[model samples]
Target: MLVAAAVCPCPPLLVPEVAAGAAPELDAARTACSDALSVLAAARPDRLVVIGPAEKAGRGTYPAGTPGSFRGFGADLSVRLGRADGDVVAERELPPSLAVGAWLLERVGWSHAPVEGLGVGESLAPERCVEAGREIGVRPGRIALLVMGDASACRTLKAPGYLDERAAPFDAAAGRALGAADIAALEALDAELARELKAAGRAPWQVLAGAAGNAGLSGTLLYEDAPYGVGYVVAAWS
Candidate 1:
């Protein structure tokens, strides 16, 4: 059953090295992420699963030792999902979003439970995502999740998707749902609209909704902002 969850934006810019001189701009986000992770740690779950958006090459399960690199972003940095024990071997590198999740885990020196990752495709249907999440939810023992994905990428004219009149409202609704752990609201998000707005978090957040459907978790919004024209929100559910 789901015991706790931390929701965060998955932009590669969250990494200080990638951000470089502009890193200071996300200090607050970093701090909020830290606090959110603390809530997960406090839950003392038996397993930790990190979920994030991925492309075709990165979709599927990633083992604890899955390697993730920031080299594509001009950073010679790499991170592992967690410590791989025994003979388990990670077959593929984590996608960019999961790579950021791994970085956040490392930043907190996560050692309380075994870790694993799932990279959900942006084009995946909402029902499929929810079914996948339900599978994770049925696993034995206490489980925690670190969900990563961005809201709208079109908050401003300079945003990745360019400014869209619907972007702000979409992001606002998403932020509110996540902050309140409103499973119905999350599950009801419009997939087509989300795709149009470039809100990558839609699918992942819905997965979260599925996993925590009966966990009775309460949520708190730690932070919300649109830096670099992308909506980034930090929330903790416990």
Candidate 2:
């Protein structure tokens, strides 16, 4: 079962090199993410699974040593999910969401457990997401999750998806559900509405709810903001 979870937004801007001169804009979120990961580490889980949005559902897993780069975002920096130990494993590039997750793990020097990555499609059905989460939860040992995705991209006129009246409310509800560990609320999130509002976190958060499996974990909302008009949330459940 999921002993702990950290909910974070997946944005290339989270990487200072990608943000460049505007790096300070996300400093607080970075700090909050570090704090959230600390909680996950304290849980002492046997395994750590990073979940994020992808183009397809049930995509293959990314090994711990998978590489991620921000070169596409104009940064020449590269990161690996875990430190390279000179193993000859096949190399694969992580998706943007998992890349951010990997960056967070590196930021914290995560070493408490073996780590892996799962990519959930944005359009995946709720039941399918839950089912996938259940499978992960039933793995051989204790599991923790680092869920990455943005809430909404329509918070302001200049936002990536442009402004929408529904964006604020959608993000507000999502933030509340995450902060309270309200699994039902997360599971009940309307996929149609989420898609309309450009909320990428909907599917990933639902998966987290499924993995939690009525564990009744208490939560703490560390940070909630729309720095670039994309709703970014940081929360921890333990």
Candidate 3:
């Protein structure tokens, strides 16, 4: 299976600006991701599979891209899904971590799954760009799943704390605005997703560890983001 993989960041695809330094933190991330994708592609899989939030779904449960369809990101990446020509679709479901995040949102507390709610964008989007690479053959153990999701900070439910002020100025307040309820929701999602993706039965599919990315924009909604977070994080089933 081409086995190509991409980092699963939360938004804007990481500002290129935050990734610079002597050690170059983001550089290392980019390097690892680039290397993994290259390696996977070389081995060859029918196509690469990435787990991203699709516009078609909401933050309720683990949702996968509609089978036999592709979600293309403009001027960015286009994700190709399903082997409709044959019959091989992802045998698994959305991981447990993702489920947790959604649950928390509906609850009264924060999920803490490291959510990066797009202050500007409508919502997290579906897989794209990475899948545009040329198709290769399928190869097990040849796969490498790099990950990077939303930034730790976000505009999810803006709130510093219960006792703190309800609102603040600029995007900085986004972090503060997040309440315990929001944190709980994010945690639930991450936890559930991490667990589901780590299934031992799915070998060769390394679930790279990761942390949240992208602090989101200056507003308090999840839509129309330009480009902010995007990087590979740690994984599961490694």
Candidate 4:
């Protein structure tokens, strides 16, 4: 069962080197992510799974040592899911979102548990996502998750998806659900609407809801903002 979970936005901008001169803009979000990770460590979980959105080519499981790079983003930096025991080569590379998750894990020098990665597609069926999460939750051992994805990419005219009237309310509801750890609300989120709003977190958040079923977790919203018009939220559940 899930002992603790952290929900964070997956923008490469979270990495200072990737953000370059704009790094200070996300300092608060970075601090909140660190705080969230501390809760997971305190839980003393036996395993840690990092889940995030991925494209068709990136979907699937990734081992602990799976490499991730930010070279495409103009930052000649690389990260791995978690340190593997000597010479454990990964089968495939991590997706962008998982790369961000790996970066966060490395930032905190994580060593409390064995780590792995799962890449969920943005267009995945809600039921399937939930089922996948259920499988993770039922596995033996104390499990922790670091979920990464953005709420919406259309909060303002400058946003990636451009300004959309529905963006704010959708993000507001998502933030509320995450902050309250309302599994039902998360599971009930309109997938079609989420697609229209370009909320990349929809599927991953739903997966979290499934993993947390009746786990009696309480949540705290550590951060919420729309820098660069993309919704970034950070929350911790324990």
Candidate 5:
């Protein structure tokens, strides 16, 4: 079952190299993410799954030691999902979203649990996401999740999707739901509306809601902000 979870926004700007001189803008969010991961480590789960958005649905699993790079984002930096050993095996590169998750894992020196990654498509249906979440919940031994995705990208005039009048209310409701561990509300988030607002977190958050099941996890909103015009949220559930 889901023992714990950390929700983090997946912007490449979270990386110091990518942010460069503006790196300090996300310092608080980074700290919150670190604290959330500590809670997961403290839970001492048998398995930790990192979930994030990708270009396609049900993409293949990313095993431990998988590599991700930010060179595409103009940063000559790379990271591995787990510690490297001589037993290196070839693997596909992680999507940008999962790459950020990998960065977070590396930042925390995550060695407390075996790690794996699941990449879900942004357009995936809520039911499918929930089914996948249920299957993950039933896996043997305790499980923790590091969910990565961003909220509305249309929060401000300079936002990626350009100022959408509905973005603020949408993000506010989402933040409230995540902070309250209101699974029902999360599950009920309208996919169509989310798409319009360019909220990439919809599918992954629904999966989280499904994974939590009826387990009654309590939640805390660690951080919430709109930096670079995109809504970023850091939250923890236990």
Candidate 6:
């Protein structure tokens, strides 16, 4: 009897003082994320494993985590976190994150990866959300998975429309006009990612659309009303 999930929003780039002028929109995102985190904290997992690189780690010793590593979220609920520190996860045995990464690599190409202190790294495994649940010994009916990444990791603050990298609704026509390749890259990445997550054993899977690289596109948000950014929440029994 465990079913709760939330899809948090992803602004273009969140700064240290996220609350200075990030009211309303950021509040909504926080509320959404807090609800999901509460469910996660209540899961009572042996560990909370996150497959992400260290945000402020160095190029040599890494920040503070390793791939397939473990960490303590708190006394109520713990998690096993995974990070590469200064390097990328081994392309093959990156555990539950490889397949989705492969799909993105095949389409978006590595040139678009947000490395170091920039965009969302190739840390999220389409199946890692499942892997996390299973690793913590959470029963099939009591698990929560969160998949987060930079909504628009391709464009620049110096770009035409998104001059400040602020998260906003993307106009479809303007997006499509930017370039088909970029749009295809993100779409392909997200589509395959969603499918992979669904197949990873998270029934009732839900994908919260995201927007991070739409300024370079050539279309307007018409039917797909997915907005400028996307967030996905995957939850199911172990």
| lDDT, candidate 5, 1-238, per-residue tens | 8999999999999999999999999999999999989989988999999999998766458887789999999999998877655565746798899999999999988999988888999989988888888888888799999999999999889899999999999999999999888999999999999999999999999889889997779999999999978889889999
Candidate 2: global Cα-lDDT? Answer: 0.90
List model 1 lDDT by residue over 179-235, tens digit each.
999999998999999999999988899889889878999999999999999999999
Better of 1 and 6 by TM-score: 1
Write candidate 2's Cα lDDT for 145-197 as tens digits. 99999999999999999999999999999999999999999999999989998
Give the poorly placed runs of model 1, Cα more than 4 Å off.
57-59
Identify the runs in model 6 with alpha carbons over 4 angstroms from their true place.
1-16, 53-120, 123-146, 152-238
Clashes of 5: 0
Q: Give the per-residue lDDT of model 4 (tens digit) for 1-238.
A: 9999999999999999999999999999999999999999999999999999998632499888899999989999999999787776766788899999999999999999999999999998888889988989998989999999899899999999999999999999999999999999999999899999899999899999999988999999999999999999999999
Q: lDDT score, residue 132, model 1?
A: 80
Pairwise TM-score winner, candidates 5 and 6? 5
Model 6 per-residue lDDT tens digits across residues 1-238:
2232222223321211322444444443443444444444544433222222223221112121222211121112111123233655432122223212222222222221112111122334424323332332333333233333323321334433233222222223222322232323333334243232221211111111112122221211111112223222221111
Q: Residue 116, candidate 6: how far off, in angstroms?
A: 18
Clashes (backbone N, CA, C under 3 Å), per candidate, total: 0, 0, 80, 0, 0, 40
Clashing pairs in 5: none
TM-score of 1: 0.98
Q: How does model 3 fare in lDDT?
A: 0.25
**Which pairs of residues collide in candidate 2?**
none
lDDT of each: 0.93, 0.90, 0.25, 0.93, 0.90, 0.27
Sort the candidates on lDDT, descending order: 4, 1, 5, 2, 6, 3
* Shift of residue 89 alpha carbon in model 3, Å: 24
Tell me the TM-score of each prediction against the true structure.
0.98, 0.96, 0.29, 0.98, 0.97, 0.32
Candidate 2 vs 6: which has more lDDT = 2
Clashing pairs in 4: none
